[model samples]
Target: MLPLLLLLPLLWGGSLQEYPGYKLQIPELVTVQEGLCVIVFCEFFYPWHVSFTTDQLCIYWYWTGDNTYSNRLVATNCQNLVVKTETQGRFHLLGDPKTNNCSLSIRDARKSDTGIYEFRVWGQYVQYSYRTQLNLQVTDLTEKADIHILEPLQSGSPTNLTCSLPGSCDGGRPLTFSWMGDALNMLDPSTLQSSVLTLTPRPQDHGTYLTCQVKRRWPQVTTERTIRLNVSYPPQMLGSSCSWEAEGVHCSCFAQAWPAPFLHWWIGDRLVEGNSSDASFSVTSSSIGPWTKSSLSLSMELTSVLRLCCEAWNDHGNQSVTVLLLPGKSASRAEVALGALGGAGTMALLSLCLCLTFFFIVKARRKQAAERPGGMDDEDPVMGTVTWSCRQKPWPESTPAQQSHSGDTPPSREEQDVHYASLSFHGMKPQKSKDEEATSTTEYTEIKTSK
Candidate 1:
């Protein structure tokens, strides 16, 4: 009897939960997935020394949506106690009263099952009621994770992505995240995604799809997010050139790349004017294997001496080609002007000398005719020279003066030029006005001088 009396106190007494004399052993939080089962561990203390039996004791489990700690009846062993229709078969008694356990079991849990669950004991135990509460959360796993990244991913650079369960599941089991379905092997294994995934992208990896799967065994919930990658790579050299136009220079560069690259024309270090950093310039693109063939063009003002370059760039790198056009002209206009002037002056002087010779011969002819036959008026002529007008002709340049055949005697009249003039000229003359015979000789009086 003494031993029984002492053990009775140990049956239900010392407690840190609920009222000072009562104690309860229930986890403060519990989590489970919808259509799954959840067990809440529970044990409570009562005044065993007073008196109690299976028939005299009763246990009740109540739930409340209000966080204010008010009780709403759900399931109970008390006679005529009301149980919510929704929690009918869902709530079960997984514990026995003989072991002082008030644990509750819930099967086929739903999202609406989240709330504060409390335990109540009634019957003969010297108390009005003994109670304690635990928060329970139920999840359905309907929402998917979010993925964010640069629209067009850059190659050779690290990119980060994240995937996590929403905040709705209060006390769910530990979640794990993993990568799947990346045949290119571009995803970094060292970089995991409990909520985060990081990787260095490559050009060849463009159009690859990656999946992030999250799993939680407590509720057996699994969620996933799939992402398609568009990797950007710098331009690869195909061809480039800078050629001269009539009034300007035309430059072009062709390359192969992913995520089409930007191209521009440069003269030394400066970007070409009128052809700037905008898409206003010409561009042609075609899809190849894993890349795009892009061609770009720019036109800028021409310079006497030109050093031109064409450059192409993208997220990854850049390529360039240079062309140099040295300074100088193929032919000069100054020399043509000098040759034309010299030809005009020589023809003018030759005409002046011919007029003087004709005047002297006419005077001599009057004397001979007067001395021979018919009459004539004898007169001395004035020195006023009559300059004959001559039309411009398409003539070739003059040849060197012919040497005096018999140096002592005067040359024949048809021998051409009578005297020399100090005419200064240089270079070949301009072409004639038309394609006529420019070298035709002119007629002059023949002179036979008696030796």
Candidate 2:
């Protein structure tokens, strides 16, 4: 029972002892931008009976190991440290001892104000003490903000953007900058004095804007400069040599210009429209210069003959050139040459066909005549032999009446009857006897004598 009594007293004594002294809490480091405000807070604890009195409270603020009066009197209860004559208008000491709240405020800060601050507090009786370390980081708001270029104004040209902010600030303060567009951040902190952004100009970059934001130890402040990029190039002239030979209805017009330009074609008094044909254009840039030259070609087919006009225009400006084309003279020459060639070729073909036809017709007629029967006489003996026989009737033996009347005297009826009988026998059949042969010879001889 005695031991229990002793233990209870010991426990009561432990509980009755004063809690630990109030301790000021200070962050290892604090960052603030110029022309801004920051708060440094201090915390502590005290017994309930010890009421906070101005006489009992003595608080002092100073730099580390500061011996000069100028460094020692940042704040003191003996002399009221009013807002006037303070480094910053917002600087002040605020606390509620009942709640153990102690804090400091700084306003309109500057880069030179960056330093470590020490707070010392003393209380009556126990004479409690607390110390806190403060690191003030001073940065420039202007330094924390930046500028960036979004795009370039020329197509196919190299362009650069810049993100720039004021760089004159406390060296200990760090800054970060970035871009807010299609371009990736490629700036190296070591090489960059402040911040910058860049990109190459392209056709896709037109009508786009770029922005820049900067971040530092303080709350981020942004300043943006927008750039509207318009990628433009020279107009392209398309077509072949400007000459009169290329005159006709709906002549082909073409121009190959990038960043497409307005195109038009004209012939004589007519404004030829919708007669443009596909044209090829090319642009080449000098590697060392800012200018690029472009060539364009277009073909226009038209019916009229006059000066051919080609005009190309863009946002930059307009360019046009005219070529005189005498359709009558040029067309006539071309037509004559073509017609002569065609007629010559046709006539040569016709002559050749006619000659061939004539030769074939003559050959065919001769072949048909040769093949016809009874068309040619068979007279030449060298080719084949042919025998022919002729039959003759012997003259009738001289009438016997006539022979008897050879001397001019008249023969009687008996002579006439003998002549008739001989004539009748000859008509029937003549005998091939020696008397007949001799009588035939006598008749032949008498006829020769009569002749």
Candidate 3:
């Protein structure tokens, strides 16, 4: 009995009421896609071996904005609440008493199910409540699928395509349908229906892939389907076929398939990736019945000789054709001749400019020489000589012969005088006493002459 007493406290510690009641927890705030399930956790403070049941617990779900419960009640403890028509077969309530967990599973979820959910727990001696909100997001599978083009139809004919759900449609508002591609929403479908997109046969409409998508507005459901178009038409090359005028070495492949076909370019056995210099494609479809054609163009940076391969493909298969860009004998010879002519013409133009520049430079030098003083000799007929006199020194004594020509040719005389004066001015002076008597006699003679 004393041992039992000692163990009493231990037993009580291990018992269910050791702590407060069970607390529910839910970490997930949102879920996506229809028929997806969500779990709400219920944890107890004390570890207890309790029987799991939802008999006394009530769970209710409502959208965030509405005061009343959402149209759909996924699960309830009483099983009396009416299940929403959309969620009828999609939801379940699971409970684990030992773990105190009450979780809800929603099958084929819808956008309408997105909202907050409330849970209420009521027992004989304990009444506890907790709430966890679920943000349900539903996405349509159609939105994720790929759209492609199919080929092999007559050129210049109409083509038709069907876009349907790729997989099973889990019961919900069937996804709404829409189509887009080169036509840019040519077929505007307001509701969810199998859409048939049609285009006329034209070379430009050849390789485009039209896409069809299915989407639901509420509980966002989506699905997708795609079909390639094959509008058979004889291949027509865009731009020019002549090799000399070819803009680039690469070209685009196109076919008018009922659905748009895949376009590709090939050189011999190698595939060509189209770029600015290569051929590319754009597609458009006619509004009338099943005829579509695609235009294929090849471009190259004017090569002398080349061979090109063009191919188009779809899910059914692919078709290829080869075109030989052989230069015509005359055309090839003409191109070579023209290339030589162009080079010669360029060289001639450069030579002419150089010659003109040299001529102008010589003319300018001659004109400058003519304009510069004393730059030319007296004998040079191209320029006239100008004489410059030195003002700082006296003129030299000119010889008799030079003096006779001095007045006629002032420059030569001035030069001779400059040399004589430069030499004589250094040491020459007047004679003294004998000059005095001579001076007096000369003065008397000058006075008599003045009278």
Candidate 4:
């Protein structure tokens, strides 16, 4: 772009300062941002009889004063005149004094350079300094770089972005351009240092920041502009997962795209939307930035297997994934049957063991009774006592003989021998009373005889 200094003379006429034999025209005031450039439009006139040639005429622009020794000589046309070290290259005498134009150009302006400036002209025997002074004001830079996108960024599509400062010129201080932000990491490193950058955007770059920074080399001033990229892309499936929990099937889906896609689920042939439920399945969905996620749960009895489909879409395109979910009831039934068989087998085994224990106990009791001697009374455990009794045999033969002859005779009675015995048993010894003997003695034995 052309510098603003080239157009100053055509746009604005300078203030006129005239005298008896000399006239000068230059702007009364000029303002510029720091690290920028400006031009002072000037014109001067003299009587046509005052002759001068191009070789003899010289122009000088000074800072603050007209004396070359006291003031800073910033720009001059004299071959031997040396400009100030600070403004040597940046200050230039753009207008020719032979044509009566004393215009001045200043570049890479600094705040310290703000002051009044005077213009002067010299010839073989003539020298003059204009009474009209030019006021130059250099203020803090408050301008920023402009960013222009050639086209809307799309995933996998190449595009260009240009950065330029409003008042910058190629003739002024050389500017350094740089791009920054998360989105720039995906671009070529060589392309990041130029005023124009070319890049192919991706879905990951959407909503990320891109910054254009402009740096002026002389003053080291930096200005930047940041923009968020709205990269459009088709829906991309990030992940899908499913699980069985609490006799139900739960599934989740994740996807990314521009314009925040809408999410839907298809259970078998039924379609489900956000927070919507049917007789068989329920769905919940949410969208944040360019990513959309959804969850689905099936609570119905599944006697047959079904397919769960998760789909996402937007203005760009669509993406979907399907997963097969086996019937929940089928697995549960098999597990339940195995558990029932195990429980019944355990109960049967317990009953058999109890029966065997009871039979063994009864047989042991019978064997103990059979082993005891006849007519011997065993002591009762609860009472701790024993009793024994004996009786004689009856006369069987006499009774049969008497049955034939003793119809009229009265029967006679006869006594038979009978014996009785007693025994005592104690599980523990008892203390003797004071009246009892010290030595242990048998207390009693009862016996009876009958014939």
The estimated TM-scores of all candidates read 0.36, 0.28, 0.30, 0.49
Compared with the true structure, the alpha-carbon lDDT of candidate 2 equals 0.44
Cα shift from native, residue 82, model 4 (Å): 16
Rank all candidate structures by their lDDT, best first, as comma-separated numbers: 4, 1, 2, 3
Question: What are the root-mean-square deviations of the candidates from the true structure over C-alphas?
Answer: 30.5, 46.1, 37.3, 36.5
Model 4 scores what on Cα lDDT? 0.66
Which lDDT tens digits does candidate 1 get at residues 292-373? 3434343443233344454555556655444443333222346434543655565566657657866787787666656753
Ranked by TM-score from best down, the candidates are: 4, 1, 3, 2
- The sequence of per-residue lDDT tens digits that candidate 3 reaches over residues 1-451 is 6555434434554443332433455654654544333444434322223354334544444344244343345555556668555556666666654345566655555556666655544443334334334444555333354443344444434555555444324543445567766644434444224455555544345465656776655456665655554444332211112122233222222333334444454443455443323243222222123222323344433233334544444443444434444322223446756754765765466557657965886687677767867733232222121221111111245657677876784665445432100000111121111101011100000000000
Which residues of candidate 1, in runs, are more than 4 Å off? 1-139, 148-154, 168-171, 174-176, 181-196, 204-208, 218-221, 230-250, 255-262, 268-270, 273-306, 313-318, 324-451
Off by over 4 Å in 3: 1-21, 27-46, 51-74, 77-91, 94-101, 105-116, 121-127, 131-192, 195-451
Summing lDDT over every window of 10 consecutive residues in candidate 3, give the lowest-scoring window: 442-451
The reply for model 4, stretches above 4 Å from the true place, is 1-30, 38-135, 142-146, 180-188, 207-211, 222-229, 327-451
Best model number under lDDT: 4
242, model 1: CA deviation in Å?
A: 5.9
How big is the RMSD of model 2?
Answer: 46.1
Lowest-sum lDDT 10-residue window in model 4? 385-394
Write down the worst ten-residue block by lDDT for model 1: 442-451
lDDT of 4 by residue, 1-451 (tens): 2344333332433334434456778878899998888877888875432354434777788897434247777888898989888787788777667677788878778887888787777664445566677788889888999999999998777899999988766578789899998877766788899999997887778888999999886557789999999898877666666655665667877777778878887776666777897776778888887778899887776554455667777777665655544443434546746754765765465557647854775577556557766543342212211111011111244555467656756544532221222222222232211111111111111111111
The Cα error of candidate 4 at residue 190, in Å, is: 3.2
